[model samples]
Target chain A: MESNQNENKLYILFFLVLSVILLFLSSQMSWLRNYISYVYTNTSHDQVVNGRQVKNYFTLFSEIIEIKNENEKLRDENSTLKSQLDTISFLIEENTQLKKSERFLAKKSKYSEVNMFMGEGLEIGYIDLGSDNGVKKGGVVQYGQYYVGFIDSLDRSSGTVKLPYNRSSFIQVSVIKPTNIEGLNTDQLKRLVSEKTKSKAVAIGKGDWVSVENISTDKGVADGDFVITNDPKIGSYLVLGRIKDLDRDPASSSITSSIEISVNYYDLNRYIIEIQ
Target chain B: MSEVIITIFGIFLMPILSPFFYGFLGINVTALFSLLVLRYSHNLWVYITIFILSLLNDVTFHLLFGSTFISIYVSYIFDIIIKRVIPNETRTLDLIFTTISFFLFYVSLEIFMNLSSGSGFRAFENFQELASSLLYSFIMSSVLLLISMFRTYFSGGTGHKIIKL
Candidate 1:
């Protein structure tokens, strides 16, 4: 009788121990909880293993079918976007050549050729191409026809091109209009025009931007006037943006104003960088 | 000479063996293999041996230090608890308890690291993976238990009896 009672006691202890273990495991292992949840939700379920949770085996097959259908839909959308981008790039290159010929006919100075090399990834993207390559600091960088940024740091093999849209980039520019004005000396106007051509400016923010400061407003600057870098080294005018804001200080002897300039970094794949 | 040879072999072999590589087969199976291969006589000695082994495992593999220590300690706790409750330990109990204990140990460690680092840890991400790991450990531990039983049976004569408690 005592041995039988002890056997019964041992069985009870075994059950208690197993229950405690399962409780502990369920709390700790998310998989165990998921299995329990799956089992509880599927009332007719019997066994739950790692790979196959068989709820009468029929339902498991249905779940696999649904997942395969979703996968096919994502792949089709990915291919469509890639084709559209390819067509857009081809048109932009053709248009830039036409504009280049128009500028040459107008007797405007030619844009400088800026070579750009794509890097592996962002982490080590700043590796320079080579020492022999003419890439230098303060040289402008562009993606396609639109201005991207400038070379901030360079090594023997690579350089870090600081994007104009990057929070840190800033440059000085001047606004120019279509009609030439009187009383502005030809040399002084030329100097101002040259300076406005490829000069540097700091990036304050990004959006559809216009107008920039540190340029004289008394030169008959208006809302639609074109601003470009004022650096004399880069002789050609790179269209920045249009003036959206103009605040003239009337009391000051020297005219000081703020003008918005235009350059959309996102619209182009390549940039026209000016070597300084 | 045998003891020295075993000790030297353990020292040479441990760093080369990795839980990650073994965990591909299953975390539990790898863990059970580690426990069986590194088994010692005394409880204190077992804990210390496992701790050192785990540390060596961590350093060689470039894993987070003390991870193996946490795993081993949790297993040791479960071993003690099972030994106390089931005086005559069955193979099934051993398998179930070790699997549960190992699972809990990994889950707790992951949770603690995630909370402390403020990022979610990805040790065993899915339910299927966890289930496989548990099964692997159970099977491996059972194999080890069977081997141990066989060794005992062969080593003793007909007059010798197996200890129940």
Candidate 2:
């Protein structure tokens, strides 16, 4: 009984202290945390379960389960592909407008002249065109007319572009209300256009949401109005996202109310990084 | 050997089940882990294994480093205190201990995040989510523990009936 009196207390104290130190060090150096995550994921690729390797489970029942999961995955892929096809067709027209301008396209005749690089999210990407193909850092990456991202770092074979949804993305924006008004009076149309076009707002991306911190509370901005980038490089109006909702703080009679807009980054499959 | 098995089991199973409990508030597997550690393991390495399990969870969930481990450690300490205070094994005590353990873990995590990132409005929103998740976790953990007890009883262990408080 004396021998069995929990000697584990010493072990617990040691580990607890070690963990606290590691935590403090990791908080100061985020890269260390990232390195730990990288190591963990790589090491646990073939984890064991019930005395058997997880990857080695190839029984008939397991196969059926695998097939079911694969089916669901395929269904998701199908929907994503369908949406990409729709976006591609929409981009084709925009490409045509770009080609007409001698300055925008330069020597390139078609939009497809610039190679496409598909990215998983705002962070990592694989560009088909790299440094060898005139792809350089500090370049504008556009998906058709809309400036989606900019090339940050590049490799000899490929480049990485930071997309709009990333926290670092900042874009100057203006609102436009697109409608079917083929026969509206000139005076009414001009007045409507003037009212809709207000002071430019800076939109900062926060993951899936983009927030406009300064928009007039009384501005006749409504849901479904298209937000466009005010970048001068691309002379044409490019759509960013639609205004989703707005909230005002009642306590402070501030002139501007914060607006939250939704921008779906899912359907983007292709991008054109303008060489610096 | 059993310790190793439980460690592996916790590491693999917790991440899979976490998402089901995590929506409004993040319901982690740390509370369940501490409870299991208390029930089955006698070695000090068992706690270390649980801590490592939480670190693995942080990596898998893309959370800040040391967040899960710190929260789980706080919960583990809470478990130790409850165990020391009331060593009796009863359904009421188990439920109370589990509730307190989970609550402490969540509060510790919230404090860490708030202090680390100065997450002001986000912290308030997260607290609301935490409240909802706390109820979900308490019900789930208690029911699962009771089920395990019943299973043990049916398998021919010396069974104790639930007593009125």
Candidate 3:
């Protein structure tokens, strides 16, 4: 028995040493982790591992069908609107109002599911697409034309997206006067963003939403105005969100407002984006 | 049957569960489960199971490899020390030892992963985050352990009596 105990100790020691070596090796071998992650991703299937219950939205088949119908209706409406706007060939100079920006064309794109969210405010999210998919850092992530986030970091097969609401996210944006975009169709708004805008304010991420500050009162910035990313690279084609919580203080020279990210992109299963 | 349950939840389910634990919940349920196993069994397979779980954990979360594995071993070392000093026979002693082991586990994990981080590593650089995470997990796991122990006590024995096999 004493001999067996010693033998057991040696076996444990050997196993531990082997594990430590393998651990070091795993860091160097990225594909190993990627392969394993793929296995886990398939198994978890959007299960909330947070130990907290996530409400199942599709408990009933009717709910799923209803959502599908709503989606179909939106797609149809979008197509009609596109056709209605196609007659007016867009005339605005696309670069007139933009800051001197990164001038790369987004020739490639991909779709990814959000793996999970992390960080202090739970604003940082990891998506399944990674460097492997030609996803570069600073890649703009969008849901169609609406700006959502930027790629913060990446592993072999996954990338972290810094949501616009993350404290670390600050995007340069121009506040479009409410009148500029009020009745304009998607194409018209896209054109309007390219022209010189009334107010240029820095959108500072403020947890669940962003706050655009330092806009002069004369700029006619209102609660319903459009906030679009005015970055030097990747011009203002994508809408950041819309202005809300319009704070106008008489004592202050500038006005501040919160930009409401209209859609809860978090609820979307897949993120499809054209990244430059 | 209990071994089967532990094998399923402790090894298979933990990799799926750990990211949620480590991400915002600030706990390592894998470590918690491993602690329970170590608290009861010195079987070689227990260590191997934890090692596999940690590996799967790092893979799933895209964390630094072996970070979780090494951290658990560090906790195991603490457990060994405490096992000697504290008679873990009573319920209170058991809880006390487990808590201390968990605290050391997180500390080791934080320090180990961050040090191995090519960036500078000061063990205490992010002390507040670590403490808050520890507090959160500790309270939660303590409640869980307490409930299990109570239920088992009523069932005529300990929650996990040392299985000699």
Candidate 4:
């Protein structure tokens, strides 16, 4: 009985010590983990494993059915977390766009939403605004700050908006990769982008989209560069569209690029503005 | 030559084979290696060498650092307890203790691994698998232990020692 008691006491002490150490190690103590890793450089080849670049040989060789099932469960959980993260990122992006739209609205107080009657050839839009409503002949019809087209002709109560894709439309534009000149503000960047026509080209109508013409191959302009309106009559420094693709002609020493406008007409752009 | 082979197998091939055995046969060669090594060897360097081997095995197994190290510690501690508790050297007790030490080593290792993998107290959730693995480990270690004895007798070692009381 006395010997049995000693054995039980030893068992208790052993369990107590083991439990404490196990718990201590199990805790996510970064400092302790880092210390152990520093002492032992071969903590893991975790980069390759975690990056999913290589097969984790241990998992391949020794993972039992139960462990595989657990991994599947964790993968499902990871997918759910990834979707939740995407939702949050989308909300953040929408919030940023909303803020930018708000600033855009504040800057242009002379914006009016009008109905667009599509021309017979689907080339131009006849708007319900005219000179009587402060509508001018040369001002742009825009969606927020995105250049859609300009007022070609205006009468007592209506006007014609020449769409970017209209065959008769021709406008001078500048193209530049969006970059922040560290110390410059948006106004300063706007002045610089409006004045520097390094990517000077004419946007000509192509019935479906606008194509850049006469751009020199040495202009340093690439696809996806922002196309800004340089025609001061239509309002200077307004973003027209992004350069979709650039096709260079070696003989002519010129490049051709198509612009991908943000707004899709006849869908979400029924209501637009004549922003001066 | 045989001794060198067994050492190499236990130190090197056993780690790789252990995974194959565990995945299919459910035999724990790692536990078996610990039992045989501690049972036979007394050299400090031998223990240190096995400890290093255990470290390599942990990396190969992708287990948390020091998992196989703790398994070695389990065997060492059990050896101490048995030597201290038993008053006489009995082969039966030696076999029983070795098996028991293997059980403890696996238990500690599984618990540590499960905890590290975010399983928490659900370590033994696959109770049936764990039980069978322990059984296979016991059988393998016991068979190897008996084979080593037979080898000892054939080689004219201490296995054939006899005396009239």
Of models 2 and 3, which has the larger lDDT? 3
The 10-residue segment of model 4 chain B with minimum total lDDT is B156-165
DockQ of each: 0.02, 0.09, 0.17, 0.04
Worst 10 residues of 2 chain A by lDDT: A46-55
Top TM-score model? 3
lDDT of 1 by residue, B1-165 (tens): 133443444444433333333433334333554456434332333333344455444333333445555555556567667778886756667667766666665664455445334466555667886676567656656666776666566667332235533
Tell me the tens digit of each residue's lDDT in model 1 across A1-276: 787557645643454354345334433555543553453423212111311332336566777787777777767777777777776765577466435533332123233443354443221124334344656666655433233456678776657776433445455555566433223332445565655433233223332232255444345655666555544433333444555555667764333333343333333333344332
| Residue-wise C-alpha lDDT for candidate 3, range B1-165, written one tens digit per residue | 255666767676676676555544546778777766765555566667887887776665555777777777777777788778765456666666667777777776666666556545545566687677568546655854775566465556744543322
- For candidate 3, give the lDDT: 0.66
> What's model 2's TM-score?
0.40
lDDT of 4 by residue, A1-276 (tens): 787557645643564355456446635545544564554434233422342322344456556876889999999999999999987886676456434544454354566667677776547888888888888887677655567778888897998988888998888888877653334433655776856556788888989778998787887888778787777566545677878888876787788889887666664434446544
- Model 3 over residues A128-160: C-alpha lDDT tens digits? 777776777877776545677888888867888
User: What ranges in model 1 sit over 4 Å off?
Assistant: A1-130, A142-150, A162-172, A178-211, A214-217, A254-261, A273-276, B1-165
Q: Give Cα-based local distance difference scores for all models.
A: 0.48, 0.59, 0.66, 0.66
A190-240, model 2: which lDDT tens digit per residue? Answer: 445456675466677676556664555556666666566665443334456
TM-score of chain A of 1: 0.45
Correct interface contacts retained, every candidate: 0.00, 0.20, 0.34, 0.00
Q: Which ten residues in a row have the lowest lDDT in candidate 1 chain B?
A: B40-49
Count of clashes in candidate 4: 0
